[model samples]
Target chain A: MTSHHETDIALDPELMAYVDGRLEPAKIAALEARLAHDSDAREAVAKWRHFDNLLNSYGRQADELPHSLKIAALERELASKLKKQHWRAIMLGTGLRRIAAGLVLFVAGWGSHAAYTTGGNMLASASHPYFVAPTLAGHAAFKLAAYQGAEFDGDNITSALDWMSQKMQHKIESPKLERLGYRVESARLIEVDDRPVAVFYYRNAENERVTVSVTPKWTEHGNYALRVVDLDDGVMAYWSSDQLHYTVVANDNRGAITTLAAAVQQ
Target chain B: MGLKSELHEHIGSLRRYALVLTRDPVAADDLVQETLVKAIAKAETFQRGSDLRPWLFRILHNTHISALRREKTRADAAPDLPEPIANDCQHTQLELKQVLSALDQLPEAQRNPIILIALREMSYAEAARSLDVPLGTFMSRLGRGREALRQIVQGVGRGKLSILKRKGDSA
Candidate 1:
C-alpha cells in the first residue's frame, strides 16, 4: 500500500497489482489513464511485466520427477508407517504373546547375525563379484580428489556429523579417528550413482588425508562385514551396519585404515 | 480425499518450489521427500478445512531452511538461484542463465519474496502469510528484488543498460 513519489513519477504498489492483474477494473482504468501521460510509469510497467513473464517461463521449465524416485518415495513412506504399526501391534499383545514375540525376535536377531558373519562374505563374492570393487574404487577416487582440494562445507567433527545426519536422514556417530592420529577437517554430501553419500574428511599431523563416506544401505542383500580393497596410492575399506553403508578411504597405511574401519563399525 | 491423499496432490508444486530453492535436482527430490514425510508425521496438527497448499509450502520452507542451517552452507540458507536449463535456443538459454545468476546474488529474504510473488504467482496476502511476514514487509522486499532483477537483466550487455540508467536517474 506504500507509494514512492519522486520527480513527478510515482513508483507505487499499483504497478505490481496492475502487472499481476489483481486490481479492480475501475482502479485499472484509473491507472491506465494516468499511465497514458506518464512515460516513466509506462516504462516501469513494461519492465515489471517482462520480469513477470520471465519468471512464469522459468517456473514452467520445472522438470518432472522421475517415476522411479516417486515410486521409491511412496514405498519408503508406506513401509515406514507399516513398521510403526507392526511395533505397536506387538507391544499391545497379551503378556504370554509378548513374551513369545520377544523370544522370536531375539532368535531372529541372533540367527541373522550368525548367518551374516558366517556366509555373508561368500554370498557377496559369488553374487556381487563385480559390485564392491569398482564402486568402492570410483567412490574412493572421487573422495581423494575432493579431499586433496579440501572441498568440504564444515570444519571440525561436531558440525560435520550434524550435517551428515541431516542430509542422510540418519544420525552419524563420529568414530575415534583422533585416536588413530587423524583429525577431522571437514565434511560434505556427495552423490555416487544416484545414491546420496555423506563424506567426512580428516587430516593428520603428517598431513595425511582420509575420507569416510556414509550412506544408507542401498543393496538389500549385502552384509555389514568389513571388506578392503587396495588402491594405487592408498587403501579403501567398506562396511555396513544395521542402517548404513560406510567406506573409508585413507593413505597407503593398511593397518591404520583397517583400524579406522573397525572403529567406525563398532 | 483424506488429508494424506490430498497431500499427495501437492507433490508437483512442492517439487518445483524445491528445485528452485535447492538448485540441484537430487537435492530437490530429497527435499520434497523430507517435506512429505514431515507433513504426514505432523498431519494431526493440521487444522481441518484450512488451505493446504500454503501450509504445505510453509513446511517445505522450514524444512529447507533447517537443512541449510545444519549444513551451514549458506549464511541465511535461503534458496540459491538455480543454474539455467539447457535449451536448444542458445541466445534465450544464455539470457536465462544470466538472470538466474543475478538472482543468486540476492539474499535469501529478498529472493524468496520475488520467487513466491513472481515465479509462483501467489497473491501478496497468501505469499506473505506463507513466509510469515507482514504484507508491508513483503511488498518492500518484492520491490527491491524486482529492481535488482531489472538492473541485472538490463546489465547483461544486451544494449539495454541505458534504459535502466535513465530509469535509475529518474527514480
Candidate 2:
C-alpha cells in the first residue's frame, strides 16, 4: 500500500502492482496516463513489459523438456521402493519368530522349573548351568523315536523349522532324523537371549515321548558342552555343535538316549 | 496423486529457474533432481494447503549454491566461462555464450533475484516468501539484479576487450 513516488532510487512496490494490473482502477488510469505522456514513466513501463515477456519465454522453454528424464527418475524411485518393501518383509518374519519363541518359553516354565519338565522322563541336573531335562513322557517318546518304530504327531514342525531356519540363518529338517529311528511329533520354537530354539517331540512304542531340541549356537552361546541327567527311569542328553545346540530326553532304560544321540550324530 | 504429484507439476518452473541460474541444462537438471529428491524424502515437512512452488524453488536455490561451492573445490571442474576463446568474434553463438558466462559470474544475491523475476515470473511477494525474506528486500534485490545485468550486457555489447577483461576478473 506504500506510494510509488519515493524520493530515492529505491524500487516502488506500487510499480509491481501497476505491472501486474492489481492497482485500483483510478490509480491504474492515472499511472497509465502518466506512462503515456512522461518519457521516464514510458521507459519504466516498457522495461517492465519486456521483463515480463522474457519471464514468459523462459517458462515456456522450461516446460518443453524431453520425456526421458522424468521416466528415469520415476524408475529409480520405484526400485528403491521395492527394495524397502523387501527389507520390511524380512524384518517382520524375524520379529514373528522371536515373539513365537518367547511365548513358548514363557508357557514351558510358567514361573517354575518343576513345571518345565513334568511327567518325569529325565529331570534336569540342578548343578548344570545350561539345560533343564525332560519328563517321563518326554523320555518314552524319545526312546521309541530312537528305535525307528515310533509314531508321533508331527504338527507344526514344518512351520517351526521354516521360521527357525530363516531366523537362525541355518537349515533344520525333522524328516532327516527319521533315518535315526526318530520322528518328530510337535516342534515348537523357543527363545533364549532373543535367539530361536527348535524343540522337536518324538514318541516311541514304549509310550516314552522324548524331546530333542536344536538351536543356533550363536542363538545359545558357549563351547561344546554335554550334560547327562538320569532321573526316575528316564535319561536326558544335552549337547551342542558349532552351528546348533541340542538336547535329547528319553526313558524306558539307561543309555537309550545316548544311542539315539549317536544315531543323530551319524 | 497427492502432494507429490501436485509438486511435480511445478518442475517445469523449477527447471526454467535452474536453467537461468546455472545456464547449463545438465547442471540445471542435476539441481532440479536434487531439489525434488530432497522435497519428496522430507515431504512431511510441507505444511498443509500451502503453495508448493516457492518451497521447491527455495530448495533448488539452496542446492545450486551448495553444488557451486563443491564444484569450486573440485579439481578440473570447468569454469563457468567457455574455453578456447574462439578467435572468431563475428560468430553470434560465441557472443551468446559470453553473455551466459557473464550471467553466471554475477553474485548469487544479484543473479538469483534477476532469475526469479525475469525467468520464473515470480511476484515480489512470492519470491520473498520463497526466499524467506521481506517483500521490500525482494524488490531491492530484483532492482539491483536488473541494474547489474544491464551494466554487464551493456559492457559486453560495446567491445570485446572490455567485456573479456571483466570476464577474466570476474571468473
If scored against the real structure, what TM-score would every candidate get? Answer: 0.47, 0.45
Q: Which residue runs does candidate 1 get wrong by more than 4 Å?
A: A1-11, A68-266, B1-6, B70-88, B157-171
Which residue runs does candidate 2 get wrong by more than 4 Å?
Answer: A1-10, A19-25, A69-266, B1-5, B73-102, B159-171
Error of 2 at A245 (Å): 52
> Deviation in angstroms for B163 in model 2?
14
**In order, what DockQ does each candidate have?**
0.09, 0.13
Q: Model 1: DockQ against the native? A: 0.09
Instruction: List all candidate RMSDs to the true structure.
Output: 21.5, 20.4
Candidate 2 similarity to native, TM-score? 0.45
iRMSD computed for candidate 1: 12.7
Report, to 2 decimal places, the DockQ of model 2. Answer: 0.13
What's the TM-score of chain A alone for every prediction? 0.43, 0.42
lDDT of 1 by residue, A1-266 (tens): 22354222323688777877787787988899989998767876787677666656666555455654663576357434533333334334353254445434533553544221212222135433223333344344444343232245434567666766776678878755664456776665655454556666677654667777667775544654455556556676666567877777676455455555655554
Residues B18-122 of candidate 2 have per-residue lDDT tens digits of: 766665566667777787677657555555346667877888888878887887742222333344243554334445544455555567776677667665446
For candidate 2, the docking band is incorrect
